[model samples]
Target: MTSKIKNNTEKPTSGIRAIAEELGISIATVDRALHDRGRISEKTRARVLQVAEQLNYHPNRAARDLRLNRRFRVSINFPTGIPPFFDALRSGIEEGALPFSSTLDIEFHSYSLPYDHARNSIQSALDASVDGIIAVPPNTFQMAELVRKANMKGIPIVCISTDVPESGRLTAITAYPFNCGAMAAEALFSHMNKRGSVGVLTGNLEYLNHAEKVRGFRTMLSQLSPAFSVAAVIEAHDDPHEAYQGVRRLLQSTPKMAGLYISTANSISALTALREAGRLDSVAVVTTDLIPELVPYLREGIVKATIYQCPETQGSLAIRTLYWYLSEGMRPLHFIGVIPQLIIRSNLDLYISTNKYIAR
Candidate 1:
């Protein structure tokens, strides 16, 4: 838990001092050891790093840079659909960047329709002269080209929620969606008790994350339950109506679907379709978010479970990590993986209470 040490007394002053005395080195040497500056022996560096991790030494960036008066402007580009997840992620980014209120300026942008939508957003960010860019690219080669141009112009980029690795951005902070798919199957089928085919629903497969989720679900379902197979895969684009139609079509085509797993947040439509088809009580349904629409489903046990990847954590860390890398000369880990959680009907209320959001 390398979270911020909020209280002043809990600061790492004593820990740093102890490391210096224990190593019989000057305070300056210890400082260099901590910050990875100046020429220090590899052995001493390793020893210092080991001690720091053991001590959970997290530098107070705000306190250190307060006198320096460092101010930065960051821009965010996200998708149009799936408000519950992306909105919470934005909230987390705001909370994480709170400490640097005086020193950071953030701008948010969302993309939709038209081929030049992403390009326009990039131009806006550039015109604003932002220090960094955080984006959820729309899984298109054109979006990649725009992001690459931003990187070429020397603006730091951090991809969040969804990844566009082909853009050659700094790094991406998200959960392993493939693992989410496997976990979804485990959660859905284990609860089923009986082995049978299931339907898989999700957003566009152009996203590497979505495609990987499908891959993981297919792989693990076959390995975990040989009797259970995926009967059909549908792209609902996170629209309730589209999901409803997709599920209806699935029912018409795949009669053996005893369970349904939606790997994306757009799901209310599928629930409606199931209810109308009179199979809502018979088939097991699992979704991928805690949206308001799903709350009633969970309460009635219509939707069995949801797999959340902690959007808040992802959003907060993406901003804070990029901020430190830019302002404090800290090199970050390439992949900051957020762990996923599976929520069931019994605990759905608790999850909703803590993560209450206005439904659109």
Candidate 2:
């Protein structure tokens, strides 16, 4: 006996009606089963699912089209100043968006401003009806407020690089700053044998990653070598020139400084200042992020070790997480933590290509 093949390309028109007719069930019962509404038995739902799957039935694409007709736009805001690291991150964002171009639209905004400026920018993006927002850590209060506004407006917010406490953001995608800081501290302490003073350089104190890193470094130093002391925690505001000046000031104040810890993005300046002071060889240096600016220092052994975070992954994950929430109504893993990789001269080649570290 010959059997006729069922056409799988038939479009979904009447959800409850079609299923009801095919399964010989009442429309109300089919509707309840399909939607998991009140009083739907497990057996009925299973049967409905089986029939729907066999028929290749899907939800109304026109309804979905109408719902998403506003265009799925995502806004990515990053601190400006045009750092090479941010450029890498921007490229990562583009790369991440490429695969989703058919589904979502992405817009990137760069601003060189303080906390208030970032707040205003975020508000503007929200006003523009952006479905999602991704940002590096802004000022704590501003970030918290922005996140609050976004949540109130039902827009998903993803934080990259640093986290904002009580921000109520949907997801955070960044390196494990505490673990990286602990590793840097351990490396410095091991090199110094816990006998010398170390100077710490940081960016803004309000940034969660910077603060966590400073705390982790101090904690590990105290635990591993009580004799070792953090000479000073100097704020460079993530400015290269300021970092240079801060290193100079720390060296001037503490002539016995045997190590340096850079907990932010301006490692290049610290290495430069140390080299100028002729202390590069004597002082053990550990810093965060693998930027091209730090490559010469690492290659020349001026910097003993550096921590590497995948900025590209941070950018990509932010977009992916937002899409999951908006498209599938799926929530991300709570407390997502990306591991930090410790980079030394020996294994540095694995992370860098042709002296340039591609953010990935």
Candidate 3:
């Protein structure tokens, strides 16, 4: 008998076709079963899915997108400050866009904090006719105007990490700002045994997120125990030197200061002051954000606890919500607030590993 020659030129069957062949059904039936697109008998649909799974088959997302001609451009406007937090947010944005890689073109614009550096970026994206926008909007007249312009142009904009209420954007996604501060207050209250004067080292109140933390901390603390009071609320302007000097003064002047709440990610400055004053053991410190720099302090109990703002979730939700709205006309809630986590020494390892904050 003549040896049969192998057809090396023949290509392997495509995922859908292989599934169809195995299930003894047509490709159209397999497609309908997989996508729930048309009427198909349940038995056939189940058989198609089981065979597809056994064959380790997956559809080519890029091919599907090209066939459907579904593509969109989205612009991301985020701050460049506080690398630990901001970097995590960036990673979240990337993770959120991975599934849509075949069809989504994302343009990331980084800006400095406490300024409206995103004005030009937003304007440029609008000029380019981007499909959607995700931003950390500052409360600036220029930002408001840009947001309004995008709305007029029919481009949906979603704010992350912070909200500009009057900007008239689509919606805002953030870690619950009020609860972030309230959680810190609760931690400090418990750590200090429910009776102590706590000082707040915060960033600028102009940023609504910062102000909300202070407000929530004060509100919760007062309701928890009138005996526990907020001694001083200093706006450090997110400056290391200013935060250090402010904390030093609080350490010197605030008599028997039992607790301190560093309500911004710029907490290393305040923590340094406490360490220098040799009061790290005396004061119950509650800080915001989980950065690599804070891990050592948390382990040593210099930081009694910290509020993790779930920056990744904020980033992912912002992108996903905007994409869904752009592609499928899906509308999310006016405000999506992720619950913040309180990280203490006992659970430090649970959230911290090298530079990454693992979301639980």
Top-TM-score candidate index: 1
lDDT (tens digit, per residue) of candidate 1 on 1-360: 012323233466787888887778887777787777899998998888787777777656665665687767788877677787888988898888876665677777887743246667777887777889887766678878877888888787888867778887788887888889999988888767568889999887877778888998898888887888888899876566788899999998977678999999888888888888999988899889788878888888888889998999999999989888877667677777898898998877677778858233
Ranking by lDDT: 3, 1, 2
TM-scores, one per candidate: 0.87, 0.79, 0.79
Deviation (Å) of 351 in candidate 1: 2.9
Compute the lDDT of residue 358 as modeled in candidate 3.
42
Total colliding residue pairs, candidate 2: 0
- The per-candidate count of clashes, in order, stands at 0, 0, 0
lDDT of each: 0.80, 0.76, 0.80
**Could you tell me the lDDT of residue 124 within candidate 2?**
79
lDDT of 2: 0.76
* Candidate 1 lDDT trough over 10 residues, lowest sum: 1-10
Candidate 3 residue pairs in backbone clash: none
Is candidate 1 or 3 superior in TM-score? 1
By summed lDDT, the worst window of 10 consecutive residues in model 2 runs over 1-10
